[model samples]
Target: MTRHHSPTARLAARMGSGLALGALALGLASQATAAEDYRPQPDQTPIQSSKNESFFGKTMDYIENNSYGRLGVLRFQYYGSSSNLHVDNATGLAAQAFGPGGSDLPHTGSSAGNTTTLGAMIGLYLPKTNHHLAMEVQLAPPLKLDFQVSGDAVDQSLAPTALNGANGGSIPTGVPPLGKNLGTFKALPPNFTIVYRPWTHTLVQPYVGVGAMYLYTYDKDVNNKVLNAYGEPSLYLSKPVACVGQLGSDFNLPNNMFLNLDVKYVGCADVKSRVSNIKVNSPTLSPTFGPVDVGSVSSTNHFRAVLYQISFGMHF
Candidate 1:
C-alpha cells in the first residue's frame, strides 16, 4: 500500500481533474457575465407615454410604381326609337275620310336607325392609396340605323263606289295603298361618360357610368297620303338629344376583349317635325276646289324610357 502509483495512471488522473476544473471555471464565468448583462439598471423616469408607441416610427412599406390606367373599346348596340299618341277622334275623324288609317302595326317607330358603331373609350386611374375606387372617362360615336315602315290593308268601302256606276271609286279602294318608302337617316348621338370602378385590377370589374347623349337627326321623308284635318299626310319625328345613365359590368379577357352588358336609361328631350300641307285636285268638281294649304303640326314629347343594350367591344 505504501508503494507509489504508476506514472501512466497518475498522468490519466491528473488530466481528468484538470478538465473538470476548467469546465467548472468556464460555467461560473458565463453565469457572471449573463447576470451582469441582464441586471436591471437604475429606474430612470420614463418620457410621456404616446399613443403610437408600439408602431410609431415604423417604416410604412409600399410598392413604388406609377399609377395609371387606360382603356380603349369598340362596341355594337341594338336600339329602337318609339312614339306614343292618343286617338283624338273627337271631330268624327275616320281613317278614310279624315286621315290615313293607323299604319297597322303602330309603325314600330322605325328601329332602322344606325346599329353598328365604332366606339372608342379611354379611361384614367386616379391615384388611390386604398386600391378601392377607380375613376375613368369614355367617349363613343353615333350609332347608325336602317329602318322602314310599310303595311297593307283592304278598304271595306271601296266596293260600293264601283257598283254605283263609278269606274274606280272616288278613291282607289281594296288595293293596298302605295307603301311609303321613308329613307334612312343618321340617328346618332354623341356620347360622353364618366365611370367609377369600385374594386379594380381584378378579373371582373363592375362599373357605373353617367353621360350625355346629343342625338343628331335629319328630316324624315313623309309620303303623300289622304289629307287629315291638317290637309296632308302626317308624320312623327323622334326626339333628338338625350341624357343617359348606365350600369354594367365588364368581363375582361386575357386577349384584350371585353363582354359588356348595360342597362341604359335615356331621357326624352324633344322631337321636331316638318309636316307640309298638300292640295289634292278632285276629278269631278264644277269649280276647282283650290289646293288646301296644310300648316306644320309639330310636338315635343315627355319623359320616355327606352330599350336595354347588351354589347361586346374590344379593349386596347
Candidate 2:
C-alpha cells in the first residue's frame, strides 16, 4: 500500500488519538475519588478520662523532678497515755541516803510519773522525693506531767535509828498520797518525722509519718521541802532518752491554715537521774543538811504516749 494519504484519512486518525487520551484521563480521576473514600477519619484518636486522675497526676510529678523547695510547719498536740512511767526507785540514792560524800553506789529509789502528756510541735519540712514525700524534724517543748506511784507497802524510811543512833527511827505518820507534781523542764531532744502527702486538697489530706522523739530537760527546781522532810533543801536534773513512734492525719482549713492530730508511743529506757535533798532535825530548826548526788536512777520499758493535736501552718 504505497498510495499517498488523503485529507479525510488523516483527519479520522487524529480524531481517534484524541478520544483515547480523554478515556485515560477519566479513569485516573475516578481512581483518585475511590481511594479518598477508603482512607481513615480524624475522630479515631485515643481517649482518656478525668476521675482516673489520682496522686499519680502531674502535680506530684513535679516532685520527682527535684523541684521541692523549703518548707515549715507548726503543730499542737494533746497526748493520751498508752502505758505508765516506771521510775527506778532502786538505782539512785535519795538525798537522805547520801551522807556527806558523793558516792556512786548504783543508787537506789526511783520515782514514778503519770504517762499522759500535752505539748506543742514546731517543725521544718524538707523535700526528699519531691512533693510526694518529705522529712519533718520537730521540737516538743517541756510538758506538764501528772504522776502516780503504787506498790507493796514498804516503809520509805527504815528505822531513823538505823542511821542516826536510835532515838529509835520513828516512822513518820500518815500514808503518802496517790498523785504528785514532778515539776517541769525544757525540751532538749527534738522529734524526727518522715511525712508523705499524696495529693494536696481543700478539706482533708490523708498522711502517714514516723518519728524518733527525745526530750532533754533542764534542772528541776523543787521548792516544796515538805516532800523531803528527812533532810535539807535541794534540786534535781534529769536526762531521759525515749524511742517514739507515731501516726496521724491533717485537716486543712481556710486562710492558709490546718489542724494536725496524732497518736504516739514513747518507749522507755534505762534512766540515770540526779537528785539532792535536805531535812532539819527536831529541836534545833537550824539547817543541818547539804547538797548530795543521788546517782543511777531506775526506770522501766513503759513510758508516755500522747494523742490529739490542733495546729496552724503555712505551706511553701
RMSD of each: 33.0, 31.7
Model 2 C-alpha lDDT versus the unseen true structure: 0.38
Estimate candidate 1's alpha-carbon lDDT, on a 0 to 1 scale.
0.39
lDDT of 1 by residue, 214-298 (tens): 5555434443343332243445555567777867777766554566655556675654432334233322331333332323322
By summed lDDT, the worst window of 10 consecutive residues in model 1 runs over 57-66
TM-score per candidate: 0.45, 0.47
* Cα lDDT, model 2, residue 203: 67
Query: Would you list the C-alpha lDDT of every candidate in the order shown?
Result: 0.39, 0.38
Off by over 4 Å in 2: 1-130, 144-179, 182-189, 198-203, 227-240, 254-256, 277-302
Query: What stretches of model 1 exceed 4 Å from their correct place?
Result: 1-114, 126-181, 219-240, 255-259, 277-316
Model 2 TM:
0.47
- What is candidate 1's CA lDDT for residue 63? 10
Clashing pairs in 1: 112-145, 112-146, 112-147, 113-144, 113-145, 114-144, 114-145, 115-144, 277-294
